[model samples]
Target: MIPETLLIEYNATLKTFDKDEIIFSEGEFARNYYQVKHGIIKMNNFNDDAKEFIQGIFYKRQSFGEPPLFIDVKYPANATAIEKSTIYILPKEKFYKLLQNNKEVHFKITESLAKRLYYKAIIASEISSQEPSHRILRFFDYLKNDVFKQEGKFTLKINYTRQQISDILGLRVETVIRTIKQLEKQGEVKIENRKVYR
Candidate 1:
């Protein structure tokens, strides 16, 4: 958490976005980091083939944009609000100052980065050798372990459509649908009007 004084000082400068609105674009200046106060945002990249790959779908109370901004590089992914959202934006210099003044925040950010890297490593590992079905299963298992809110039932802010999900996991939409149906048949999930309940 940012210090109370700092939050107050910075609170008035934040911005809000509606569903599907772009928060930032790839190759944009990395001058600010955003703290999500409400709703969800999806971060993704487009390959040379012009296909979008889902990198992450972050929910409320999460923060992103540090890695690129810290290195003073352009944003590597595009961030879009998946739902109506409010986010606080702190300029790079002020953010660094906040980190310096709050040791806990510094520790927390480092820990977050390490965890993200671990997940990225897992995705990379699977992409190298795993079949599409296995990859999707592993991805879902990861959600169950890390992001799911309950046992036996998972509710996620799935910002991507089936096509986007298919692209992310390198599976065809038909394959993704078939795999999802398999899961549904096994009572692992209930697919009803895009609300995946498990």
Candidate 2:
């Protein structure tokens, strides 16, 4: 993600939304670059049956909905506030200009987009070819190493709830619950105080 200082210096404005508020809907023109100042935002899609699938979650300081801005297209999915949140918004033209002027920031954005693409490819393979436990572990391991970046020999706290994990992994919540217990039994993960640890 780009630095907050850069966002501010580029004349980014702050916007706030309540929980469950839609920041932008699918098919809307991606006119602004958004960075989370506080709370969480989720990018999601719905199937014909109305089942929601989470594309990704953005935590504090993380940016969301960038591919459209770069590719000159509408948003492919909806972004919603998971809680009361503040976001820094940079107009699309200004955002493009800033990236043009900042080579390092552009490289960083490229790396981020590359990582997202890798995750999508891996998840797609998991969904098509792997078992439930393998899919869950692959996601947990990726989250630990890439997102959380944990290293020491201790329990790592996870931010996503089981239901959220299920949604993200395209599995049922019941399957997630059962799989988690199986993982605990295998000492792959721990369930302590009703919280998950990797």
Candidate 3:
């Protein structure tokens, strides 16, 4: 992510969003680069029947909705604030200029985007062919290993809610609840005081 000073130097603006506020809609032309300054943001889409599919969740210092800015395309999903959040917004033209002037930052952004692409591919396969339990465990593993860079058998607390897991994994909330309970019974996960740990 671009540093706050650099973002400000490039005329980026910091804006606040209330929970559930739509930052941008699907199919809108990409005009800005957004990096979270505080709280959470989720990119998502709804099917015809109004079932929501979350594409990705981003946290502080993480950037989202960049691929469209790199390529000339409309946004494929809607970005919404999951909590009252502050975000740094740099205009697309200034974003391009900043990247051109800062090679190291540009490489980091490219690496981040590549990782996201890999995650999407893996999730697509899991959603298509894996069982609910397998999908859920893989997701937990992904967070621990890939995102958090944790190693070995160390216990890692899962921060996502059951409903959020269901949304991310394309499962019903009931299914997620049942699977977590099953995982606990099978000694695959620990449920302590209603919190899940793996």
Candidate 4:
């Protein structure tokens, strides 16, 4: 992600959003680059039956909705503030200028986008073919290993709620709950005081 000072130097503005506020809607023209300053943002889409599918969840210092800025396209999903959040917003033109002037920052952006693409591909495959338990395990492993960068068998507490995990994995909340309990019984995860750990 771009540094705060650099974002400010490029005329980026910090704005606050209330929980569940829609930052941008699907099909809107991409006009700005958003970096989370505090709290969380989720990019999602709803199907015909009104089922929500989470495309991605971004945390502090993480940037979202940049691919459309790089390519001339409308946003594919709606970005919403999942919690009361503050975000740094940089106009697309200034964002392009900043990247052009800063090669290192540009490379970092490319690397981040590539990793997201890899995650999308893996998750898509899991949803299509894997069992619920397998999908959940793979998703948790990705969070612990890739996102959090934790190694070995260290206990990593899950940051997402069961409902969030269900939305992300295309499963029902009951399925996620049952799977987690099953995983616990199978000695795959530890549930301590209602918090899940791996």
Candidate 5:
């Protein structure tokens, strides 16, 4: 269902992208915020070695592009669709003005930014304090607890591969594989092909 508020204060724009499509590149003008009505979007950055590191992945009912637009800065990471996607575009100025007039909108934006910062701090803490396998396990634990629940032995969603998961967790693919195998051995998780079990 579309938000009536969005319809009144914003404009819906349909955008289509194929799998692995770059929706917006790093350093692009963040003139609008996007709402994902369907499909998935992954935000990634290139490391010093030029390997794309997945920072975050979002699915249906989620939104992105807010921080850069609100801060009046270029995007810090690239946004790519993991599959075919459709997004609703909300122009920054209109959105900002609406927020300025609506205390509820203002509070909601502030709350979202605070939650994002908290997640970033958690990621930094995990990188500093945990070993590779532990970090990957912790990452999966987080996904299970927050993103999806266990269904039998596997997670409900299969959004990432070992390599992409490793990149996001700052671990090597080999380490990710080893960690998952260990989980499977412990009956904590199972893996078939590249699908995850929990």
Candidate 6:
């Protein structure tokens, strides 16, 4: 993550967006570097059947859609605010200059992307042939242990809803609900007040 001091150095502007607002649509020219200050942002695309598939979910202090600024291409997916959110936006050129001038920040960004890539790789492998339960647990574990960097016995409080989970895993919502219930029965998860914990 770029520190607040560093964002100021790059003249990044903090912008607020309403829930369900489109940050940018797929195929649009990428022009800014966005970092979430609060709330959830998701990059997604709809398939031929009109089903929505999530590319990635970005949370507070996280950044998204950086590849286009680096490679000079149109966005490959749409980004939207899942809730009323605050985001810091830096002009693409300024962001490039900022990265060029700040080796540490650049390294951090690279490291962050690398971790996300690793998670994607794991998910890709799981989705290829694994059962629903295996896929779900593997995905949940990665998000909890690697992406979130949580430690100890069990401390992950599932944030996304069951439908969201199903979309991410390429499964039906009914399947996700059933699988989660089975997981809870098997002591693989804990559901309290409709929130999942592990």
TM-score of each: 0.85, 0.97, 0.94, 0.96, 0.85, 0.97
Model 1, range 101-175, lDDT digits (tens) per residue?
778888988988887888889888888899776777677777666665445565653445678678668777898
Best-fitting candidate, measured by lDDT?
Answer: 4
**What C-alpha RMSD separates each model from the true structure?**
2.6, 1.0, 1.4, 1.1, 2.8, 1.0
lDDT of every predicted structure (CA atoms) = 0.77, 0.92, 0.93, 0.94, 0.76, 0.90
* Candidate 6 regions with alpha-carbon error over 4 angstroms: none
Question: Rank by lDDT, descending?
Answer: 4, 3, 2, 6, 1, 5
lDDT of 2 by residue, 31-149 (tens): 99999999999999999999889999998888999999978899999999999999999999999999999999999989988988999999999988998899999998888888778
Off by over 4 Å in 1: 1-6, 9-12, 152-160, 192-194
* Candidate 4 vs. true structure, TM-score: 0.96
Among residues 3 or more apart in sequence or in different chains, the pairs in candidate 3 whose N, CA or C atoms overlap within 3 Å are none
Give stretches of model 2 more than 4 Å off: none
Residue 33 C-alpha lDDT in model 2: 95
lDDT score of residue 134 within candidate 4: 98
Give the residue spans of candidate 5 off by over 4 A. Answer: 1-9, 148-155, 192-194
Give the range where candidate 1 is weakest over 10 consecutive residues by summed lDDT.
3-12
Better of 3 and 4 by TM-score: 4
- Output the TM-score of candidate 2: 0.97
